[model samples]
Target chain A: MSNAIDRGKIEALKSMLLSLHKGESIEELKRKFKDVLETISPVEIPLVEQELVREGVSISEILRLCDLHVELIRDTLRSSLLMDVPKGHPVSLISRENEHIAKLAEALNVYAGALSKASSGEAESHLKAISNILAELRKSRLHYRKIQMLIFPYLERRGITAIPRVLWGREDQVIVKLRELSTLVEKELTHPKEYPNIAEKAMEVSREISDLIFREERILLPAVWILLSEGEWVAIHEAAKDIGYLIPIDVEWASRAKLLLPYEVNGVVTREQVESLPQEFKFAALATLAPDTYEVRSEEDLEFETGFLSKDEVEAIFRHLPIEVTYADVNDRVTFFSQSIFRKGFARTKTIIGRRLGYCHPPRLEHFVKSNVDDLKAGKS
Target chain B: MSNAIDRGKIEALKSMLLSLHKGESIEELKRKFKDVLETISPVEIPLVEQELVREGVSISEILRLCDLHVELIRDTLRSSLLMDVPKGHPVSLISRENEHIAKLAEALNVYAGALSKASSGEAESHLKAISNILAELRKSRLHYRKIQMLIFPYLERRGITAIPRVLWGREDQVIVKLRELSTLVEKELTHPKEYPNIAEKAMEVSREISDLIFREERILLPAVWILLSEGEWVAIHEAAKDIGYLIPIDVEWASRAKLLLPYEVNGVVTREQVESLPQEFKFAALATLAPDTYEVRSEEDLEFETGFLSKDEVEAIFRHLPIEVTYADVNDRVTFFSQSIFRKGFARTKTIIGRRLGYCHPPRLEHFVKSNVDDLKAGKS
Candidate 1:
């Protein structure tokens, strides 16, 4: 159902963008904005913002689009909660904060309803509850300011600049009005005769904050989805922990949520594949073969293979031959041995195959063999 | 004069070879023998033998051709030196040997010259001188045999198989005839009445050896020119000193002849070039550069340069880099280095450039550096 809605939004957006003129007037842009809000889902606003940046469109245009987006989400959520909210959801802290604002909005509506019914005592209690919620809401402005100033810069660097700035600006405006309304409410709360006026101002502040919450959900979160890779989102999630969320969480669920937050969204392998591979083999395939082949030959028979000859062949050959042949693979692996039968001793390939050629000999002789072989192969000898 | 004759003979030989039919009878071959002799120079006889071998031509055919070649050289020298007795001329040795054989032939032309030459008091003195000369020649045969059997095999393995075999075979046949004639002389000296028979046999052997000298000069020497490199010729000349030459020589004149031999035939530099080059740059130019460049960079750099860079650019950049870099050039020479800046205090480029990189380090650290570079480049670290 979500895919179907997203596909319809994509088609509508394509048609609306194609119809735009070179020098579109503000009135034409406003009409196009209304058409987009009417046709497209609120979740797609951040994707459109990210696409605009990718297409090299100006950040200001994306911000203006975000403003239109906030209004659509605010209207949509007025009659019902956002579809994203679920009980104990990973983003439930934001949902809880939204519920508090919704309750405040409901309390203001109740007071207004009571005033219309001529119950002045019930209106006075509703107005007092509204003033207390406004005070609680004012305490969150500093937290929102941190996101605006500090967090937005990081997102901007990642090209998600426009939506955050627009949403943060609207959030700041709401905070300013809430503070003003709180001041008015304190003045009126001391004078009970002005309770209706205080309730009206409190209602205005709650509505503005409700609009900001709608913008955060519709624009900001979707923009993050479009702009950030899974790894970057993980980093942002980590940094956000220092600044406390508006609502608390169960520790176990939070940890699980952190794990699920796609650490490598662009990764080719699924998380299971990465976890299943042996750690030693992770980068082993990237290694190249040693520069030279280890050749072992028998003195008794000149019939020996060029590569990976047996130790028996090497020993038999060197025993009878007037000359000696010693080899190191490109990896410098000492994978051969030639023991003379006259000397009555045995030399094992197993002891040496993985060992370095140098360790096969006494330290004094190692340098000579290396330099000689290097010179010989290089044709210096 | 020899070069012009050789070119003319080559053209005539090509025509003769083209006219010859497959499976021609011996009588038909003998009928064409004189024409063949006129066309083929003595020097080309060995090559013809080799060409016959390559063509899978019959051995009897090659032997017949060789016999014709011997007759051609004998006839040519006889006619060419008929009137000439130029003392100490370049060809004086051949002229003197020819005149002695001609004198013996002339003596046998009349019964009086033959009987008096055999029975006169001067005949005994002449016979004794010939006997001593024959003994000296016999000793020289032993020396020549030593070179033919032992030394020529070494040259054959060095890819110079044809000329030595042909020259040695001719020398061996001449030595066998001389020994037979020497035995005849010993028997005749014991019985003066049979002097005519012994003297006739002596004349025939002397004529055969004289013809052999002409064959050696015209064919053997020129064949050697084609087969042995200048360095190999010099080595043969050096080895010849230990064994000694067959003919008595004026040491000064022989030394002058040795000096005149072309030492850079076929662009093969003489032993002098090998000795003249700095011990490091003695072989090919590839040998000079490979070791030096190999030493400077790790195997990683080798892969990068070989896999990506143009061959010329890799060489130029490697030389231009500030640090001294020596590689065991493909010839395994400590053959490469760059100019290092710190000359007086630090390691000097002059001191280390052509020196083996391993040798430049102290004995204790040499193994460590090679192992470390190998390990690092191999991604063992």
Candidate 2:
């Protein structure tokens, strides 16, 4: 049966990772499992790794073998289709952040190499460069946060849990390592004794970050691009705006598509959907997916602490109100304002949405509004 | 030199219109002014009419001459390009509503004809049918309301004031006639002597509505479509939603273009812009438009009664607020909910921005929410 072959392949992948963790060379392990590596699907690597974690193989140990695992299956992932995500779309923004993260990772490694070989007289500059790169590299957490928060839920709803778990584990490891490396580099600024050790740690974190980027661009984005509908993407894109982006985003990629939430999907990937998926995800897409059974309102409906309401009803209420209401968020951004049916007290249009509160006022009143906002923030009002 | 020629043309047009007002036959007048009618621009009709009013020619006289005027220049206006407006766009929506309005107008005429031929027994039924059609016909006011509120302001802001004024005059006449016909029909049920008079008024109103529709589709839409940017269309589309429509609108036509207000335009239509306009509008587009010199805040800034604030500052203030806020309008529609930076009160997303307040709550609380809304409307709370 195909199940037998799948089990055999996962077992082989697990052993190869275990051999790499036990100090076997990646090249040697890759050669020994060349046939298995070539046949391994992108989704299978994560499943096997999750299995190893359950069997008491430590996360750090698996993290150590990640580069080896990535190396083994690099060719297979590389051959999967690369989607041309449109500019300003959530996927495109994530991919752009990864490119920036990759450059910083490479910079950290380069400066680490320089720190290792630099004469004692020139060692301070290299340490400073390494520290700067590490701090910049730490900002990749925002990039990772979007993936975990905005994208993972859609995949988890489809029962594709292993990929998120494995990717998250690697991302967490890099985050922790980057923090420690920053602390170590600062301490070394005075002691100057752990130069070689700090250099080695920097290289390790750099490699881990690089490996995660490869997995995201090759495995995760391509799979989601195929699986998520325009509605889901619209939901993701809208929510992601609140979280902020790592880059200056382009003009919004407006979608007239209806909003769709993860809970709305039936958790079944049809044969046609599977056929459209990249080679890296075809098996996972075709696999039996556990239905997301959590009961929820329609995506157009909002569940407040009191009850639920659809979007149409909400908009109607605002327009029907007698008094005009304007709301500025904590950061002084003009996020929303109400338009009364009979009269608008002042000239306010949808264009004013997302503009700065200070700028909404004339120059004379700008200071007055800012002070009022400050007073409110200080709990004086 | 061109001003003299323009003056001579206006004088000739005035004389021809005065002759028509003096009970001249339309066919005879068309022969007399064939050259002037052929060369008359779309904007000139409104301008010359405005002039005639300034020179003491009554609006009723001009209204009487309208059919003659339309007949004489119909061939030239017919040669103007008809744009294939995209579905759901404001222009397309207006045109679609006009299509429905035209059908009602035709139906009114048909019923009026039928009423003229009906016996005393059949006359009451014809009167009932006329009343039903008139009730439906009166709903076209909502269509006219959108044009007056949403579309006309953009033109007026450009200092092209004559067209909106002339069109509104025609629209007002049709509305008043429709009302009077409804009243006369109701009274005719008791006193059948005025049946012929009621039928004649119905035909007249129908013809007027048809003429207004022709003017809207041929003159106004084509001109504004050329003048307004995607941003302006976005603003118009957003504002028009509150006014409702004559017909069920198609899906929203979204544009990612930045919002541009009429005041933001320099009030000058360049040579290139004039060239791109429809043949009927070329003279208007090229004319020396009076500058709209009223100063205002940027389109992205909202001018409140107390002060003004740009959209960004307003949004920031809302986001930084500690407590989550949800707002429902007078109609119990949930128009807005504040998104706190920290903990959210519930699963309120942007998707629920326009939802019904009752639907946003649990089923058990739906009744409670409804009563609270009713009590608020009653001003008891």
Candidate 3:
């Protein structure tokens, strides 16, 4: 009975897309989309879209239809398709990150709005605001990097191949464009004649940013929602903490999360209970995670020729260091790196720590890394 | 009794050094040195030398005398001052490494001799030989790096500060010269006119390598002998196994040690008795090591996005890769590296793994790393 109903919805999806393609009225398409949406499941949506493509709708045309579909189903999505998550979940963190990014995008749009006006005339201040907001948005690179490193690798491991291959490449391009736009805007700040050139790039960047937000919400999140388990979500969040959020994480918000809240009928929680419970519970959650990355050392202090130190002191010193240091041993294993606190010289994570350097780069460039290492070991270079 | 004897030797050391500076004969100085050697242990050697310096002997004059003093007491020195170590101890490994280096130096000397003897006839063969040997000698950089990463850091920790600071810089210079010498020899191969330059650089490199061996065995070893405990030697040896020896380690020699051999009266121990008793006892030896660096993770496999892997597989895969991977965590701590199989790229250790990146480098060039990281993170570069 369910199979027959899905088949009917798939047929309806094709005809609605076909009419939307034939320049049907927005009102007519919305009415058709709303009626069909009632019967369509998330799993069937992809199958229906694939069917529409086979029936001669171009991917670009379908992508346009997808945007319109979102408009018609937006209210319904809020109630059904979008799953609400408790705090500390990966999806929840990603959603919060997306919300932060949206605010940054909004600020950029406001600045661009004033700049577009012929006589707004506060060019210097407007440029400053543009640069500042762009700088804030630039930190989205960290969020993207977390996805690339912590999330995508896990997705790839689970045989979810397409997103990492396609979306990962696109994400890298986004960061590159974001960097170029920042440089272009900074140049315009110094030279007024360059404003037109930078303005064009800035507008391109803005559109790309808007499109990225759209794809992440409408496409990326939904795919990830069903794929990742509760445990994997917690692991990603643990890794994400080291990468950090764009803004200061709200301790109060995290402390008062719903799932962990004690059930009470108007009973006041004590200060001691409130302060210690969350952290205690958080550690307990992590302890249940896979042991590999979170291997807690049994010993307290490391012995050296001079004296010994706690692990925390050694880690603190590494962070405080001015120069970044990395050590790859004789076998060419990268054994350690001093992550600098002053600036992020490069992107790295625990997954990359043990990954073959060959696999680290794209397949096309893998041979280059291989040859250089050979030449170096052979003392040819 | 020991303190009174040491006081008497300190006075003798000053008088003998003054006489040596004023052109005393070897016979005269040897007689005085023999008597003083009875009272002076390795720990007291530095104090005796300091007394000589205060009594108006120049450091250079004293260093020259120290070499002659070693020659004078060479035979007696082995019996008295040269402390023996167990088969698998760090000192024994260093001795074996030294023996291997000496053989390479000897080969280089022989090759250089033939190349220097008025031979323009076999330039191709000679260049190949030079290139081959120099390439072999370049692997000494791994040995030198081990000294820097493993030994010097420990020495520095033990408050034997001056030698590590001075020698570490000099060792870096030797590696640099070795690289330059290789380039010069390569140019000589292509263009014959570069032979004079190449020969000069080769000679300098040859001298530096020989001098390094002398200082390490003579000066460094004695200092280390008194300063490091037996447990420390084994710990260093364990860490050394990961970095590896310059030559293939002879397991046979390591297995057959004398000190731990029972004072048996014509009775050979069986394999079962040896295996069980030694392993059980060795644990007791390692149990005393300062725990920080040696905190081995008990779990077998590391959990990744795709699946789980034994730490052995992760290490094996890391070793086989062409590229080197290092991860400095968000806190800027040197966390881990994959030492690759192709060529040794960088030197690292468990101690340095947790160390601050700031302390790894010199202060003067610190800002270059800091600024570059800032620019990268700011998306300004």
Candidate 4:
């Protein structure tokens, strides 16, 4: 199915594009291309691009054709989108933040338009509103940061690296443009001649933010909603709490689902899981079958001198201990350490486990610890 | 302060103990020993016992004296108890379960009395009621098991071993008695002539369970409430969910406190912590000061070839991965491995880190893995 492309479906989609190129309005094309849209899935877009390139079509022309295709399928994307989620859920909270930012972006555009049209008296008030909106818009970085940190990693783990990287790149661009536009806005306040430039820049930043919001709501989040499990959502909710929300999250979303990491996902989307997915994802997911091989799920007890404990219990015991305890072998190479959750004494990574004990401590305390270790080794302590 | 006890206070308590032994009722002694009770703390019990021993008092006599002292302090212990907690909090839930079990024990006693008094016709209904009560009482083992598993480990880590162990002993007795009495009750249903013996055993079990309830409410819970932090309670609540509650817990108790284990507690109880403690714990807490010692609270990032990540971040990255990744040194000794949350394929503990790679797997897979490693080492397909 991955290798075989339906030539008939491709020809049908290409003819739809040809019909639109011959001066058919987008609305008119949408009505005609509805059947063709169902036939051509999103995964087939790359292959279609390849086939179109192999013919006499230019790359820029293909991109224009793809953009027209997206416009035609916009309703389909919205219809298959995440319409409702439990309040306080990660997806719901993120979508709420997106809604808030969209309003701010709309307000920014309105203020920018007002500033350009205002009389001298109204210009002050309009500029003030623009600055305030920019300040609020700047806080959306927290929203974008959460997307990059909490959500993107799961996609990366599932081998969907390109999408997250591309989205992150666009998110970073929005952040950078906002910062530069803020500086320009500040300059505009002093020299009033720079008003035109600031207004243009603000509108551009506003447009970029709106575009990202559309991409998130239509593509990224809906796709993630299909791909990530409840356990992954729980983790995202926990990590997102530290980053915080644009709007207050008063309700507590509770689930009995255990914490499942990306590595815990066996790569294969089972038939039941695929069946539950929306139409847009089902075709792509069914076509791309990943191997469900070699998972490690061991909860067997390990007997110690004191008692029997599972590895998780042992790990938890070590983490909860108050003091730092690192062990060095007789050869003086680091072997193990207790990973106290509140590690206040010294900074050490698991990478330090195989390193020499001398390199484990801060340089100032290195000699003192080395001497103490030596004294103990020599039975002099 | 731990080593030294006020001799005047000890002598006062000794005389009070003597008064109880010399034909005074516990109620009369309690009235007389009000001032002496203020002078002597619970920690001073051992010191007063030592003084009584030096005065040539018999151990049995001193034990009776101590029992009288406990009766005198009953009001004081009750006064310093955990009066209220959020509905779904672990301590609150456990206390609620205790209340339910106490009512069941009372019903068991009532049913036993009725069975002994009723004619043969009424005995059937009375016995049925007793059997039902016994079934409910048996479920209390879930409650006891939680205390032993979830709560005791924290107390053990805090170096307060004896209390958890002693309470656990009494809890085990209740469980064992309930099992034995359940079997005997079945026998009584058939034989009917065993009513006298069954009634006597039922009363004994009822008394024992009631006594445990008194101890848990007065001593165990009050001590635990004072000693445990919010984080510990959160962990207890999470673990208790798996064991389940005897009563329904409708409300979701929420806390923002991070998971702080017993080992994370620096031994010293700060002045602020002491100030917040109930009157019963303050004196003992203030007198016994332990070393604050070394704490590890590092959040510094470790630079890797790809990017900089905190140790926790690296640990989390490993945990959340969808695949089990184990790295061995050139010597074929395991150095590091991803600790996947769901270890489905193999049961390897952290102890396997320094073990030879061949021994890390099952015997059958050991040779297969070894051959593959050798082939890779020699650059063979």
Candidate 1 lDDT (Cα, whole model)?
A: 0.43
Question: Which candidate model has the greater lDDT, 2 or 3?
Answer: 2
Candidate 1 chain A worst ten-residue window by lDDT: A288-297
Candidate 3 lDDT, tens digit per residue, A1-381? Answer: 132336677677667767877889767776767777666743334345445544555444544444444443343332232466565556556666766665565445445544544232556675777798788888897777666655654443333344455666666676787788788778777876555455456556665665666566666665555444555555566556756777555542233222210001112223442333333222332333221121112265443322233455455544655555444434554444545667544333322232234433333454798898889779786
Candidate 4 residue runs with Cα over 4 Å from true position: A1-81, A119-122, A271-381, B1-381
What lDDT tens digits, residue by residue, belong to model 4 across residues A1-381? 274678886686578667766878767776787777777764455456456555545433454454544453344434364766677888878877876776677567656655555566656666777888889999997898778767765654444545656677778788888888787777767766657567677777876787787788777778788778888888778768867889899678978898654435555666776686655456656666453232223345443321233445445544644555565555565445556676776333333333346544334455798899889789684
Q: What's the i-RMS of each model?
A: 26.0, 15.2, 21.6, 22.3
Worst 10 contiguous positions by lDDT, candidate 3 chain A: A258-267
Q: Residue B239, candidate 1: how far off, in angstroms? A: 94
lDDT of 1 by residue, A185-258 (tens): 66666765766566456546555665666655544443333333444434444434534556565342323333
Query: Where does candidate 2 stray beyond 4 Å?
Result: A1-80, A278-280, A298-302, A305-381, B1-338, B341-381
lDDT, candidate 2, B1-381, per-residue tens: 021236766787778867876878878877888787767754355445445545655445555545644453344443254445678998888877876776676556656756665667877887887898899999887788777656665665566655666677677677778888888887887787767677778877877887787788777888788787788888788767766778888777889987665544555666776787766567655564674554445465555432344545544544655655677654544445666676544334554443445545433455787898888778665
Give the least accurate 10-residue stretch of model 2 chain A, judged by summed lDDT: A302-311
What is the docking quality class of candidate 2? incorrect
Q: Global lDDT of each model?
A: 0.43, 0.66, 0.52, 0.64
Predictions: Cα RMSD each: 32.3, 27.5, 22.0, 27.7
Residue A229 local lDDT, model 2: 86
Give the higher-TM-score candidate: 1 or 4: 4
Candidate 3 C-alpha lDDT tens digits along B218-317 = 6666555544445444445555665677877665233322211000111222334323332322232233333112111226433332223344544554
Task: Report, in order, each candidate's fnat.
Answer: 0.00, 0.04, 0.00, 0.00
